[model samples]
Target chain A: MIRVDHLTKKFGSFTAAGDISLALARGESLALWGSNGAGKTTIIRCVLGLLSFEGTISVGGRDIARDGKRARSLIGYVPQELAFYDDLRVWEAVTLFARLKGVARVDLDATLDHVGIPDQGGKRIRELSGGMKQRLALAIALLGDPPLLVLDEVTASLDVCGRAELVALLGRLSGQGRSLLFASHRADEVTSLAQRVLMLEKGRVNAEVPVNQFVAKLGAGSVLHLHMPAPSRALAMELLRGHGFAPTLNGVGILVPVPATQKAVPLRLLAEARLSVDDFELLSPRDASLGQENHA
Target chain B: MSATALETREAVEAHAPGMISNVLTLAWRELRDALRARSFLLYSLAFLALGLGVSYVSAASTGSLGLSGFGRTTAGLINIVLLVVPLMALSTGAGAIAGDRERGMLLFLLAQPVSRLEVVLGKYLGLAGALVACITLGLGACSLVLALQGGATEPRTMLWLAGLSILLALSMLSVGVLVSALARRASVAVGTGVFLWLALVFVSDLGIMAGTLAMRLPVKSLFLATLCNPLQAFKMWALHSIDASIDVLGPAGLYAMDTYHDALPWMFGASLIGWIVVPLLLAVVVFSKRSPV
Candidate 1:
C-alpha cells in the first residue's frame, strides 16, 4: 500500500539516497537490507514526510507531499532510535500518542493490550527494559491501527527471543492484510522474516530477490564431513555419487563437496544405507564474500 | 437511515479536537511546565523583589531632591516595570522554539495534524501569559507600597502601564521566536536575544549620544534618535503615562518625531503585531520545509 518513485534525498553536497524507487503491497513483508549509512533511514524518513526529498511518496493512494496528514494517518512508523518522554508512564505515553493520532480514549486500553503492554500501562518509561521499550515504541506506532507499518531496524538491540517475538508479530500482522517494510542489517533475521528482500549497498539497491532464491544462490557448495566407525572408504565413495564429487577418506573422516540442493538428499541416503556413522555434519560455505559485498 | 447518512454520522462522531482546542491544550501544558520550573519562578520572583525595593528607595529619597514623593515613586515604579519586563519576556520567548528543537520535542509536536502557526501562537501566548503573571505580581507590590506612602496611584496610569508592558512583551516575544527559528541552537538563540535587547535598550542610546556629541547636533536630535529603538518607545510610553510634564525623551522623542505620532502608536502597535506575525509565518514556512535532522 506504499509506493516510492525516484526518491532522492541530499544533505548539503552529499547524496544520501539517490533515485530510489520501490513499492510495497498489502499483506507483503519486504526487508530493506543495507550496511550502516546506506540511506535506508533516509528513505523511510522521506516516506514519513519527515524530510524534504526529490521524489513522490504515496501511502494508501494519497501523495505524502501533497496530503501528508492523510498519508501519515494511513501509515505507522517505528523510528530506528526509540525516543519518548522519560517522565511519562508507559500507558500515558501510548495514550498521548493515540490522542495525537486521533484515537478515542476508550480504544487506548485495547490498543495497549494489542501491543502486549497491558500490564505495563502504569510503569514509567525509564523502568522498562530495552525490549519492553521497543514494544512500547511499537505500541505508539500502532496507535491508529494504520494499514502500513514501516519499522527501521526493528530488531536491532533485542535478544534472540525478543527478535523472534517481533518477527512473529510482524508475520501475524502481515497475515491480517497489513503491509510491512522492515530495515535491518541482520541477514538471518531478515531472511527468516521477510518474504522478499531488497539488498542495498551505498544508497542503492544492489539486489532484489525472493528469500528462497537468495538463500539457494547464497547457500551454494556445502562441505559434507563424515566420521565413520573405522576406515570405511567405500561408504564415503558411494555417498559422494551423483553430487559430482569424489570422496577423500583419511582415518575415520570423509570429506565431500555437496551442492546445497543435495544436502538433505545425501544425508537421507546415507542414513538408509545402514552405514555405521559415528558423527556427520554438513557445513555451508563461509559467507566472507557476503561481508565484502556489504562493505562494498 | 441510508448508507450516505450513516457514513456522515460516523465521520462526525470520529472528528478530533478543533484548532482552538488543540492550541489551548498545548498552551496549558506549556504554562504548567513554566510554573513547575524552579529556576524560572525563582528568577522572576527575585526580579520582582528587587524592583519593589528600588521603587521604595526611590520614593523615600525623592523628598531630599525637592520632588513630590508620590509622583516620583509612581514614576520610578513605572520606569522599572517598563525597562525590566521586556528583557524577561525576550529571554523566555527566545528559547521557546529553539529549546524544543534542542530537546527533540518539536518533531513530535509537529508530526501532529496541527499547523505550525498554531504551535507558534500557542507557545507565544503561553510564555506571554507567564511573563504577564510575573509582571502583575511585581506591579501589585509596587502599587501596595505606593498606597502605603500616600502616593497618587491612578487606575488609568496603572492600566496604561499594563498595556504598555504587554505591548513590549509581545514585541520582544515575537523577536525572540524569530531568533529561535533562525538560530541553530537554543543557547545561541538566547544569547543573541539578550544581545539584541542590550543593543536596543543600552547600545543604541549610547551610539546616539556619542554621535550627537561628536557632530555638535542639537540634543533634540539625540532625543529623536531614541524613537528608532523599540525599547525607547516602551520607555516613552511609560513615562508619558506616569507624568505628562516629565519629558524623558523630550518632544523630539521617536514617538513625537514621527510625523504620525498620533497614528504612530497605532502604527507602532501594528508594527509590533506584525513583528509577531511575520517571523512566525516565516518560522512555519521554514519548519515545514525543514527535514528533522
Candidate 2:
C-alpha cells in the first residue's frame, strides 16, 4: 500500500505535481491517467521518494524519508526506459537486480518463465527485441515478489501482441492481490488492468473514478483494430467505411475509430461483412501509442 | 521462525545495509562497465604500446637485453604511465557516472534500497578496479618483454614505479569522479575531466615555469610548490627512489634535500595521498547532497 498526502513537486517556478493527494490500497490496483506533462511521472517519482516534494508519502506504512530503504524494499519498479545494460545477458541482469534490490532469494529461472522469457537468460540484452526487453524489465520488477509494483508506461514500446500479453500478465498479477500503481496515457490499458483511474490534467488530480465511468463520462471513443490477412484488408476497410466510420491502414492492420455510443454498430457491421478481426481491444481516445488521435 | 516470519526476516535483511555490500555490488557493475568501454580500452592500449616501444628501445640502446636493459626501461615507461593512466582513469571514472546519469541508469540504481554514499563509493571502487587492471596490462607488458629477454633483476624498482603510477591514476580518478558528480551533462563531465588533466599535466607546470622565471623564488618554496601538483610529486617520488641526488626536479630536489633534510620524501608521499583523498571526499559530499535525478 502507498499513501501520498498533499504531494506537490516543483522545478524552480513551475509545478510538476501540485497538491496531488492519493492513496493506493493494499492489493488494490490503481492507475494514473494523464496526457504529456500532466504530472503523472512527477507523482510516481514522488511516491518512489526520488524527488523533493512537499508532503507525506509512505510505502506499507513506513515513511519514505525516515525509512527509505524499507519503503523501497516493499516496492518493485519498472522504469520507462527498458535499458539495464546492453552487454549483460537477460538472466544475468535479473540476478544483478535481485541482488541490488536485496532480495534474499529469487528463482531466476522461475522469474524468467513468469515473464515468458525462459530461455533468454543466455541472450545479451542488446540482442533482444523490443518485446523481450520489456518482458525482461517486468521479470526484473517481479524479483522477490515485492508487495507493490510501480510501472511507468508499461506498454509504451510494445506491439499489439506484446501489449496484450503484458496486459494479461498484469491482469493475473492484479487478480493475485499485489498493489499495482501504473502511469499511462492509454485508456485501454487503464480499463484492462486498473481498478481505479486517477485522471490528471496540468499537475492536478482532476478526477478519480472507475475506468468504465471515466471513459463513459468523457465521451471518449475507442479505436477498433481489425487484423486480417493482406488480401482481406481492402474489403474490411470498405465494409468499415460503408458504416460511416473513418478507417485508417496501420502497419499491422486497419484501424477504425468507434465512438462509445456506436461501438456496437461498427463491430456488428464488421461481423455482418464477414471481415474477421483476429484480435481487438477498445482503445481509449488518448491511446497515443496505437496511432495519432483523430480530432476530425 | 515460521515460514512467514522467515520471509519477513529475509525482506528486512535485504533492505538493511551499513553500505559495504551495496558499494561492492555497485563497484562490480562499474568495473564491468568501464572494462567494456571502448575509450578505457583505447587509452589503456595506448599506454601499452608506449610501454612496448620504450622496452625494446631501451634494450637496444643498452646493448644488453637482460636485467640491466629492463632496469633502464623504467625511467622512460614512468612518463608514459603518468600521462596515459590518468586519461584512462578519467574516461572510466567520469564516463561511468555521467553516462549513467544521462541514460537514466543512475535513477534506476538509486530507486533501489541503496543510499547515495553507496552509489558513489561503488562507482569509485569500480573505476579503481578497471584502472588497476589497465595499469597492470600496460606496465606488465613492458616488464614481460624485458623478462623474456633475460632481464629480471630490478623487480623492486620496476614495482615501485608501477605502484606510484597506480597511485597517480587513483588521484586523477578521484578528480574525475568529482567532476562527473557535479556536472549536469555527460559531455560536460568528460570535458571537465580532460581540462583537469590538461591543467594538472601541462598548465600547472607551464605556469610554475613561467612564474619561477619571472620571480626567482627561494628553492624551498619552489620545491613545495612543485609537490603541490600530484603529477610532479609523483614524478619526483618515482625518480627519487632510484637516485637520491636526482637532478630531474631541477633545483627543487637538491635545495629541498639540504633545507628539509629527512622530510622531503614524506611530503611527496603525503601530497600524492592528499590528491587522492580530497577530491574523493568532495565527490561523496556532493553526491550525498544532491538528488540523483
Task: Please provide, for model 1 over B116-211, each residue's C-alpha lDDT reduced to its tens digit, 9 standing for 90 to 100.
Answer: 666777777787778778777777777677666555556566667667777777777777877887777889999998898888777887898789
Interface RMSD of 2: 6.2
For all candidates listed, what's the TM-score of chain B alone? Answer: 0.81, 0.91
Report the Cα lDDT for residue A44, model 2.
Answer: 84
Error of 2 at B108 (Å): 2.2
Q: Which residue runs does candidate 2 get wrong by more than 4 Å? A: A220-262, A265-296, B1-18, B64-71, B150-152, B214-220, B289-293
Worst 10 residues of 2 chain B by lDDT: B1-10
Q: Give the per-residue lDDT digits (tens) of candidate 2, residues A176-284.
A: 7789999999878898888899999999989999877876755456777666677778888887777788888776677777776666676687688777767665565
| lDDT of candidates 1 onward, in order | 0.69, 0.79
DockQ values of all predictions: 0.15, 0.26
Which residue pairs overlap in candidate 2's backbone? B66-B151, B67-B151
Q: For candidate 1, what is the lDDT?
A: 0.69
Candidate topping lDDT:
2
Residue clash pairs of candidate 1: B227-B254
